[model samples]
Target: MSELKQTFNSSLGKKLIMALTGLFLCVFLIVHLGGNLLLFKHDNGYSFNMYANFLTHFPPIEVIAYILYLCIIVHAIYAYILTTNNRHARPVDYAVHTKSPVSFSSKNMGLLGSILLVFIVIHMGDFWYKYKFTHSVGYKEYRTNLLTNQTTVTDFTPQTADFEHSQSFDGDTEIIRVKDLHSRIVASFSIWWYVLIYVISMVALSFHLVHGFQSAFHTFGWVHRKYKPIYEFIGTWLFAVIIPLGFAAMPIVYFIQSLNK
Candidate 1:
């Protein structure tokens, strides 16, 4: 038991965990990006929102999403531990370190990582919590725009004289509100500062992956003269394409919306 614990606690075991989780997250990002890109298609909001609604409510999918969230948390904890250990080991910061022909993103991995961590927190709080906890059957009111430039009425009214209760509104008619998902997303990216921050965070993510993707493989003792190049090439290409496309889509959507308006 002690031997098993020791082996798992070793650096090699942690690296393998990180590499596998990181690869899983990479696939998740692709699927997430594909879903979000639908926001740019104005005619697609009903479909997109319906899709999001289905994913959130579907039992099997919700189970998988929860597991994905757990993976993210575990990955973050492991990364924090690994980084802190590395930092403690290298007690002195070099004043004049030169880049060794590495990409800028590879060189500034720590900075990139920190930015991505912040972005993830904000992203989750804004979307995940709202969708998961707030929109219950009778707990909270959903304020949606039923008409252009007009706020919709409250929909939760009691039946006639069932309104003897303190919280009942017997005279009001039930309102079915409509939501514009794309507009809300575009509004978020419309602010100049948000656009700047979004772009910077994406750049940071790209840089973080530049080193992180292939480095994970090496950390797990996958180092060899022959296969290292293959991993490097594939990792770099995937990072280059995925992060930029995913992040840039929001800004482009906003830009096009601006022109149309």
Candidate 2:
């Protein structure tokens, strides 16, 4: 216990924790982006709601969700602690301001991370809390004709008194789907202000990832003369550019679709 405390109190230990948490979040981004892409199915939210249902109902996934929540909290808190420590250690300004070899994103990680944290809270409150804690406003029932193979969706609203009983299925023939969430997402994105917020937040996320991905490798002592450039390229293209752009695309696409309607 004493040794563990000593390590955690040291600079390297805090960095290792950040690296591990950052890598875990990177994996989460891939999974989350894949799920978000389901919004483009044009199925009136059946696919997306079903995906959301599976995430919340699956026992293993629920456990993982708890861990993911913990990781987010710990990562943010440690980041604040480390930033404060660094600032305290350098209280005195240099005699002359000099250009830093580190990139701008690298120097502004704390600010970028703070922005991302705010975005996460808004995101979770908008979706996760509504879906998990409160009853869905209603669901859509998708019915198919057996002979013609034609499909139709009907909107449903459960009795307020029986809201707790609302589910994704109504009976043997009716396939009740959660439409409330899909409607919420679409409506939220339709508003110009909301879409603007999303776009700006994703830009901040891109900057954060640009520095964080490569910094994680440095924290792990994995950076080498031969592999440094390769790491930088991967970090720039995959994490910094591709991932954020993928996320940013979702809101933009949906907002455009909403405009068309």
Candidate 3:
């Protein structure tokens, strides 16, 4: 048991933990971006609200949400530890430090991570914390007619403040009520400074993931030469490009829509 503990307390163990947690968070980013894409629908946020409602109220998803939060904290902490230790171990740089083509992100992971951490706090505080703990987010009632396959949304007022979400059927129509997190999103994205910050953070995210994703695989000893190219391609294009652009597009589109309104 002491030997096992010592392994995890050592440097390699720290890197392994970071690898596992980082990959988990990467999967989460894909899922999260997929869900957030519903924000692009023009249905007055019916689909988006339903998605938000399911995530917060569903038992299994709630458990995963907590796990995701813990992983983020652990990943950040371990990253800071490794970064500081490396810096102290070599306090002076070599006059001719050889740089890898991908070393820009490798060297700046701390700065990129710090930016992403700030963005996550601001984002969760605006949406997650308010939706769960505060009444800052209003309510919406979405009534979908089964016959017509259409949904109409209206403002909802709960009889009790404790109410979070509800679902029911009235004849051929489904009545769903949930916190109006969609409106909160629109309100947030409408602001120019917020959009700027979101975009900048996504750029940082792209750089961070491009390096980190590939490194995570290498850390796990999966560095087969035949599959190295596949890992690099997926890491560079998916997490580093598509995911960040997908997230960045939401705010830009929403802000543009707000300008027209």
Candidate 4:
């Protein structure tokens, strides 16, 4: 137990934790982005609302959600500790500045991470926390005719104050009622300032992932000469470009649509 504690207390151990948590978060991003893509469906948010319902209500997914939250906290705490230690070791900058081999993203990770942290707090508070704990979000009732595959949406009010989601059948029509999280999302994305902040956070995410993704592989000794190119390619394109672009597009597209209204 003492040895385990010592290992985790060491710098190398901290890096290992960061790598594992970082990679977990990378995987989470892909899953999250895929779910968010449902927003593009022109089904009046029926698909996206169902997706959100499953994520929040499914037992296994809820468990994974908690783990994901823990990973974020652990990753951030270790990053802060490591960055502070590195800075304290140097104490002061050298009189003669020289270009370093480290990448720009690598050097500015602390700043990038700080920006992302603030974004996360705002995002979770605005969406996740409210959805889970508060009655601020209204409800949506989707009545679908089984034969015609047609769905009609209406503003829903639960029969009771403590009501959750429900699905039932009235003859051939399926009635589904869930919290209108999609409506909340639409309203938030319609705000210019909110969209601007979301875009800026995505930019920071791109820079943060550009370095962190490859760095995780290096820390794990998974970057063999033959696989180095593959790692670099995935890190640069998948994590650094596609993921951020995909997330940023959500708010940008929504905001643009709002302008047309």
Candidate 5:
């Protein structure tokens, strides 16, 4: 107990914790983005709704979700503690502030993180809470028979009772789908301001990742002469630029499509 407390109280331990949690979050982003990209599938909401259903229902995934939530809380709390400690350590600032070699994102992690924290709250309230706690109005699933060129529509809700209740279908053309999450996404993105907020938040996320990815490695003492440049490139280009661009594309594409409709 004493050793554990000592490690946690030390500066190095706090940084190591942050690094591990940050990397975990980076992994979570990739998984989340992959799931969200299902929104692009042309098949009405069948694919997306089913995917959502799987996520909510699967036990292992649910466990992971809980872990993810805990990680977020721990990460945020530690961040605040570390920032406070740093501030207390340097009560007197330099009379003249000079620009350092550190990137802006590195210097302003707290600001960027605060913005993301707001975004997460809004995002979870809008989607996660609605999907998990509230009753969705249900959605329609369309099935078309290639042989007869006949189309059939089925409606069902995402509530626990309704989701458990099964419907019987005799014809091959009949396909039952639950609430259309894709439509919900489209509806949300249709609002210009919502899209703007999403875009701006994504930009902040990009900047955060640019610094965080490399910083995590630095914290782990992996900053070698030969590998440092490679890590920087991966952090700056792949994680920072490519990943966020992919995420930004979802909102932009959906918003544009909503405009045409």
Candidate 6:
């Protein structure tokens, strides 16, 4: 048991754990992005809220969320350990300037990761914590009249509202419903500073993903010299699209909704 513990505490083991958990978090990010994209498809206001409601009711999914939380903690701890170890290993800072073929992101992953960690804290506090621990005032019970394709907010609980009267709309058949989801998200980012923070955090996330994605694969020994190009391409793509689109979309969506109003 002591030997096992020691092995787990080794640098290689720590890196491996970080790689696995980082990959897990990446998968989580993808799923989260997919779900958030549903917000854009306001077929009726209920589509997104209904999905959100469903998520609240899903026991299996809740379990997965808990596991994800654990993975996040483990990843964070491993990251700190790695950072401290690296710092200790390099007691002297190199004063000379050197340029390598590796991307700038690859060299500054620790800084990027720190920024991402701060973003995660704010993100959890703003959305996840509120959703889980507190009731949202923006949620209104609605009933959707399927025959007339009309939605009206009724007197029932938001979670219990039927298909009809459940949707909200901004225009005629445009389905620009001002939902609780929208309001909460919009309200959070409405502050200019929050928006700025979100943008900077997204930039950090982009850089972090730029390096972390392929680094994880390399840590796992899944790639070789021939596959390096493919790995790099996919890593860059993930950074180029996933990070910016996922985080940036929130502000942009809110801004568009504001302009429409």
> By summed lDDT, which 10 consecutive residues of candidate 5 come out lowest?
159-168
- Candidate 5 lDDT, tens digit per residue, 1-261? 999999977999999988898889989998998888888887776668778878988999999999998888888899999999999999999899878787899999988888888888988888888778766635666676757866665665454644532334556565555655667788888999998888899899999999999999999999899999998998888789988898889889999998888
Look at candidate 2 and tell me the lDDT of residue 195: 83
The digit string of per-residue lDDT tens for model 3 on 78-157 reads 98999889889997788885657657888898999999999999999989999899987899999999999888889999
The TM-score of candidate 6 is: 0.83
Candidate 6, residues 31-82, lDDT tens digits: the string is: 8877877767754345676667667668999899899999988988888888
Give all TM-scores, in the order shown: 0.74, 0.90, 0.94, 0.97, 0.90, 0.83
Candidate 4 wrongly placed segments (more than 4 Å): none
lDDT, candidate 6, at 68: 94
Q: List candidate 2 stretches off by more than 4 Å.
A: 159-174, 225-230
lDDT of 2 by residue, 101-160 (tens): 878898899999999999999999988987778665456666755556556878776555
Tell me how far the alpha carbon of residue 189 in candidate 1 is from the true structure, in angstroms, after superposition. Answer: 2.2
Shift of residue 36 alpha carbon in model 5, Å: 1.6
- Please, what are the lDDT tens digits per residue for candidate 1 over residues 71-186? 77777877788778888998989999875886776556656777877888877765665545543222112333434423233334434422211222223432332223334455
- What's the residue-level lDDT of 258 in candidate 2? 87
Clashes of each: 0, 0, 0, 0, 0, 13
**lDDT-better candidate, 1 vs 5:** 5
lDDT of 1: 0.65
Which candidate should be chosen as best, given TM-score against the real structure?
4
Consecutive 10-residue window with the lowest summed lDDT within model 6: 158-167
Worst 10 residues of 2 by lDDT: 161-170
Name the 10 consecutive residues with the lowest summed lDDT in model 1: 161-170
Clash list (residue pairs), candidate 5: none
